[model samples]
Target: MTAVPAVALRGVTKRFGASVAVEPTDLDVSDGEFFSILGPSGCGKTTIMRMIAGFESPTAGTIALDGRDVVGVPTRRRDLNMLFQSYALFPHLSVEDNVAFELRTQRVPRAELRERVAAALDLVQLGEYRGRKPQELSGGQRQRVALARAVVGRPKVVLLDEPLGALDQRLRKDMQFELKRMQRELGITFVYVTHDQEEALTMSDRIAVMSRGRVLQVGSPTEIYDEPANRFVASFIGTCNLLDATATGGVVRVEGVGAVPAVGATDGDVVVAIRPERIRLLPADAPGGIPGRVVEHAFLGDHWLAKVVVGAAVAPMQVQVPAAEGARLLRGIEDGAEVALDWSAADARVLPAEPAASSTRTQEVAA
Candidate 1:
């Protein structure tokens, strides 16, 4: 028999008085997969999460969990657990008590509750700190306690809403790996929500990128980063260099880079996007290259970020190179020094110019 999806949202919509918080959104999360909803604040990522958690009702459409409709189920009845951004730990309760609170509420036998709480603490590697109160634990420890509490019930799916947002940079990175390990061991679906692109890239098996309550695209990390669906996705996910080009017979004429044939482009104006690392810098007198002027350079530990002025464009094009290689290239070079830039046609992506109607259409649709 085919296993049902862990969670499925079919044309789900949510409205808050005058605002439509989540537009008609459809998504399916597979069993035991770590899926993420990624977007900026006010993009309705949380609203979708709330609907899945059964904390909020959809104004339209249906939601299913393991093939059973859960639209009207209350939060407590749904076989799902959520770890909020705030740890939400009880300050007065010890780590063990915090993890056992759910069991006590269900009136489980005291012996069983104690065993479950101990096992939960052990799962999070907090067994030694079971006696410590939330106020006595470190930030990461408290977050782990919260995670243990959520998983103690062994729910079908686990929802994490920016669960590591409060931790420091190093701790956050550490927890990303820990969470992935825990999810794999538990064999449960994980639906994570985050606005941080790096967090989404590192943790998720697949990410649904949203904007204004609409999902722009869904793909693996490499696909989303390397082959974005449109200009917004390309620009938002990472740093990209864009050039205005006119297409003629499948060839794009970049102002300084000359005409180059590209895939999926015909006769019209298009935007060419390439990553900084893909650009190659050469001396001004080097053959077969486009002309530019060095405007600024900054050494960033392992790499150097160089800004180069090309043609009438105001924003300088940025290129990243290894620090050692950059040092060699910058020898005797100074501000306003002419330079040559070159990149293969295969390195650039030709996209159609965004229609003005899209801006108005998105607004109207959102309205």
Candidate 2:
């Protein structure tokens, strides 16, 4: 038998006044899965989360939780918990009391409430600090307290809204793993909202990419990063070199780059998206490749980034070289030095020239 999705949105949309915050969209998050809604601010990712939480009524369509329609449910009536970015722990309450707040409101028996509160604090490693107030804890500790409070009632779903946004880079990284671990231990579905690509990529089992109040694409991290759905996804997920080209008879021709193999391409204008690490830099006079001048280079911790301007292309192509290879390969290749760029034709994706144009029919090219 097919299990019902933990959270389902069918043709869901939201509008505020005359402005549409979310377009018609469909999404299903599996039970016990870690799913992320990723997009820039105002892209409607948070709006979708709010609607699902019953805090905002959708302008259209229906929302379901475990096969039951929840479109008109009140926020408190939904079988879920929400953790905000601010932590929101009461300054006057001790850690244990904060975690017990929900159970107390439900009037759970004292024995069970105490046991549940202790377990929640232990799960978050705050059992030893249960006597301390929110103001007595560090930023990370306070965040943990808020998380414990959210999950203490054992909600079937947890909605996290950029909860780690205020932490330092290192702390944020630490919490990412912590959050994933907690989710697995509890075996509850997590629908996280964030604008940070790295956070989404690192923790989510699947991600929904949103843009301009629409869901652009949804897929696993590898699929989202390596096989983007369109131009916007290609550029938004990572640093890519997008070059305009003309495809004709199984080949794409870039200005001054000659014809590159593009099998199954329909003759028309297209844009090629390739990762920096895929482009191999070579001596300008070497056999076959695009000739260009290295305009700049920067030394990153483990690698180097070089920008090369080629042909009639509008922008320079970024190339990533390993630290060891960079030291030897770029020994005397100073600014303005001529170089050649080459890559396996199969490494590049041929997308439509227009921004956000769907490329479901697009295929990988080969020599």
Candidate 3:
């Protein structure tokens, strides 16, 4: 028998008046998996999460948790818990008391509640801080307290809505690993919602990229990064050099760059998208290389970003090189210096020519 998914959405949608927040969509999240909904603000990613949590009712379709329809169920009755960006810890309560609140409300035996709270605190590495109040803890510590409280009841699934958004960069990175660790140890299904691409790519088993109230693509990190479905995805997930071209068989012709290689290019007008890191930069005199002139460059700590205008192309092509290699290339090269661009056939993807719209024709439902 096939195992039922931990969470399932079929044609689920929401609209406030005539403004559609989420289009009809279908998705499944497996048991004990970490899934993420990624998109920019006002993209309707949060609306989807809210509907799943029963905090908002869908205008159409159905939601099932472990194959049981939960459309009209109250948020408290659903077998899930939610953690928010704000931590939402009680200021006056100690960590232990906060974690024990749910159990006490259920009238669970005092001894069992104590044991569960201890286990929860220990799992979050906050056992020693059980006596500390929310204000007494660091940002990360308070986040962990909220996490411990969310998972203490052993719910079937946990929803995290940009839970690390409030922390500093370093603290947020640290908490990413911590979140992954706790999820692994507890083996609970986690559905995380975040607008940060890096965060979703780092922690999610699979990601659903949303735009203007629609899911554009759903795939693993590597798949989404390497094989973007369309022009929008190719540009949104990371930086890419998009050039207008005409493709025939395995060759694509750029206006000023001449014929280049594209393995699976569709025969017609198309857009060739290539990652900056995939292109090689050589001295302009290099044999058989596409000719270009460096227009500008920027230092990004780990790598250097350079803009090169090739032939009669209207926009500059971006190239990213490692710090060491970038130092050698930009050492004495002035703006307008000559250079060459080269890449393998497989590195350049020929995407269908279409209008890459980031926003849809509806207002997003506010969180």
Candidate 4:
């Protein structure tokens, strides 16, 4: 028989008077997996996290942990811990005391609490700074203390609500790896909430892209990045170039670009999305390529983003190429110079546009 999920939500709904914070949602988080809920601000990512932590009760449906219902369990009574975006450390308390506070409240033996607190600090590589208060530590260090405190009690699941959001770019990247390592070593399920797509892509075993109060898609990073369920997932997850095309038989006719074979188009106008990296810039005389004029270019460390205007389209199409090749292309090209653009048929995704009444469906995916 299959083992029960570490955390599961069945038709979970949260309504604050007239506002529905979380629509009826269902999800399953496996044991020892790193799962993330990703979306924009006010997209209900935190509402879902709060529901799991029992900080907020669902208006309907059930929340289960390890096959047992925990729908009404109080935050302190549930066998789960949460690390908040703000770190939420007590400024007056020393690091050791902060990490041991939960255990102390539970009436754990003084001797055992000391040992457990020491172990938690050591796990976060802050053992020597145990005597320092929250004000005495760096932002990243304080965040570590919050993490250490959450894990000190050996909770069945840990929920991190944008735990690394306060750190700088470099520190945030470092902590992503550190958190993933810590999660693996402890063998506990981690349900993380973040609006950062890159962070979710880097760490999650699976990610649920949310919008408004609904989950748009749940899949591995590669699946979500490569085969997005719809246009919102494609556009929200990363940079994309969209082309208006007409579907006739098995071929999609792009204006000025001619026809290309597509797999899913059946009728009407279709929107084709292609990643910038998938596009190749060719010389003016190249065959089987659409002609365009270079509008602008920006250097981005290892590569360059070249914007080219195709036909009457006002929006410039972005193309990413290696810096070395970009230098060569730049030497032979200039602003307003005509060039050719090409991409493989398999690199593009065709999706039907949702109707006006279903426009709200797109908002649901942004959560």
Most accurate candidate by TM-score: 3
| Predicted structure 4: lDDT | 0.86
Instruction: Look at candidate 3 and tell me the lDDT of residue 275.
Output: 94
As a TM-score, model 3 comes out at: 0.96
User: lDDT of all predictions, in order shown?
Assistant: 0.85, 0.88, 0.90, 0.86
lDDT of 1 by residue, 31-134 (tens): 99999999888778998999999888999999999988999999888899999989899999989999999989889899988888888898899999999999
For every model shown, the clashing-pair count is 0, 0, 0, 7
Segments of candidate 4 deviating more than 4 angstroms: 355-367
Alpha-carbon RMSD, each predicted model:
2.6, 5.4, 1.6, 2.4
* Cα distance off (Å), candidate 4, residue 350: 1.7
TM-score of 2: 0.95
lDDT of 2 by residue, 135-254 (tens): 889999999999999999989899999999989999999999999999899998999999999999999999999877778889999999988877888998889999898998768988
The lDDT-based order of candidates, best leading, equals: 3, 2, 4, 1
| Per-residue error (Å), model 3, residue 203 | 0.5
Q: Could you tell me every candidate's TM-score relative to the true structure?
A: 0.92, 0.95, 0.96, 0.93
